[model samples]
Target: MGINAHFELGLGGFSLDAGFSAPGRGVTALFGRSGSGKSTLLRCIAGLERAPVGRLEVNGEVWQESGRGRFLPTHRRPIGYVFQEPGLFPHLSVQRNLEFGWKRIDRSRRRVAMDQAVELLGLGRLLGRAPGGLSGGERQRVAIARALLSSPELLLMDEPLAALDLASKAEILPYLERLHGELAIPVLYVSHAPDEVARLADHVVLLQEGRVIHQGGLNEALTRLDLPLARDPEAAAVVEVRVAEHDERYQLTYLDFPGGRFTISRRALTPGQRLRLRIHAQDVSVTLNRPGETSILNVFPARLREMAELNGSKLLLRLEVGDAILLARITRKSADHLGLRPGQPLFAQTKALALLN
Candidate 1:
């Protein structure tokens, strides 16, 4: 069971007609630009706004069904909401604020224990501190810990890092990463930042003008040439890999994926540990023949799957390596010189630029 929702809302001149389904586990990102109804759709899921024509179901429970005259109020729904700012009580200490919502739940129903939440968010030392005295990142950490203590079935985060400075966002990203991996609750993270989405999301819902343009697994949606993300100059493909071995002498780590292996700078990853990596289109180079000697390490035999005109001067190539896909962006002159065509066998030299785990 997962989340299934449909909503139609009208406010002033704007209207939202959105419907989508998300897996019960892992982060499902709602991606769109400003005024695309990302926030409005999220609010609808939280029951903060009721649409005349709407329906919502979480896992097996029906939270809202306009046709059935059933609608669960905001407080009645088992959800945790985190907005841009940490809405902590200034009068209460950090521990007290966290305990406020936590105490409402029965002991028997507590899925996340207080100590676990404290440890997960690194809030143990800041228990006695007041919200006003904590730094921006610290305040947000406490806010997240507080949400965790509520034992929510679903978590909603609307750009929790948007208000934070670069340093603060950096400070909190590790803790959020831990939460993402450790928690079983599904998260609906709303953000326009591509980097954040790449780092945290397992699934994505592409939204534009109050509608879902596409929604699928992270790799599937990002690799599709027809999608806007693939057409963007900054487009990249995400691949799931696992640590296979470590070369201590060379200080390199070998990661195994569906069809090939990637060697990168040594990381402190354990054997069999899972990882996700981002490979940008521009970082990939196509060669008709495998180089006898090359400095670039992540080279593999690839089959041309598709090609599209990126612009007047450039073309985008989709190459299949093993079972996964990688994108390469090259100038029209380069494509013409190489005589690149679909179904042709070529070698792809890739440089992994970022790691997302």
Candidate 2:
């Protein structure tokens, strides 16, 4: 249930003397700033970068051990890798390119069939088209499908959406989510984007200077103000919510969390569906008392759990509402003027940027 590794490699002027263990299932993100050895670590795991004195075991299987002289080649290892680019063959049609992996992998050992891969990645339409004819998002989907078709035990994605535009990323994210949900393979996803990590990863491994600084549930790591990621102006908390009601008249979807109901901009979500919502700290405002007339539709009475000075005059407040934890960033003057303290009751107000189902 763990991927343990001890790497020792040199990359030009920088050397990677790092190691970390990722979970068996779910998306384990390799998160860090650029040039933090995230990709190098992944490449080592994939056997692309050989470690002079390294050991790697996935799900208790020893894939590599430098001391013992045991090392499995990249193709022999049950791994599917998706790089930043689609890496689709321009010469071949999408279907042919997908079949290339199937041909290389043992025919008897393949568990994921091509039909399922095509269906899962929505590659049915693009299969007949050439790579040049398909869009960036489409090419990425084809790449994922190709990897899945190989029936790999582990999936490694190295900033798969980094090369794409916002629209392309938006187009590909849901497919990635579906892949995570449907497939049984353990995924090691590399990314520097906090938003991407928040939306996708169930487990997070924060990398700093070629070492794992923090590793835990995504919600916990993301909400910690001590981490560098928390300094982001877009810093937020993720909440799991279930669909409560959908009002066609008002064009709003009501989602029920542990503490309150949130109305988000969604139309296709059905009742009983579940979704994770990102609520930014800056979007939240604290009020000493509930106001009578406010434009904010979502307001929950919360008790301040902790408060800490952020920048010179900014303060970060952690509040608990029932089982849900919320974050609010306020000015130190506002915190003092409102007499905010631990266990003080306050209202956390937010607009309809909520997650729906």
lDDT tens digits, residues 40-83, model 1?
99999999999999999999999999999999999999999999
What is residue 271's positional error in candidate 2, in angstroms? Answer: 0.4
Which tens-of-lDDT digit does each residue in 1-357 have in candidate 2? Answer: 778888998878877888777788889998999988899999999999998979999999999999999999987889999998888889999989999989887879898998989888888778789999988999999998898888888899999999999999999998999987888788999999998998889888888878778888887788777876676787888888888998888887898998989877656877998888888889888998997887778999888988878888999988787788778889999998998889889988876364511
In model 2, the worst 10-residue window by lDDT is: 348-357
Q: How far out, in Å, is residue 130 in model 2?
A: 1.1
List runs of model 2 lying over 4 Å from the truth.
352-357
Report clash pairs, candidate 2: 274-357, 275-357
Measure candidate 1: CA RMSD.
1.3
Q: What lDDT would candidate 1 get against the real structure?
A: 0.91
Candidate 1 wrongly placed segments (more than 4 Å): none
Please report, in order, the local distance difference test score of every candidate based on alpha carbons. 0.91, 0.87
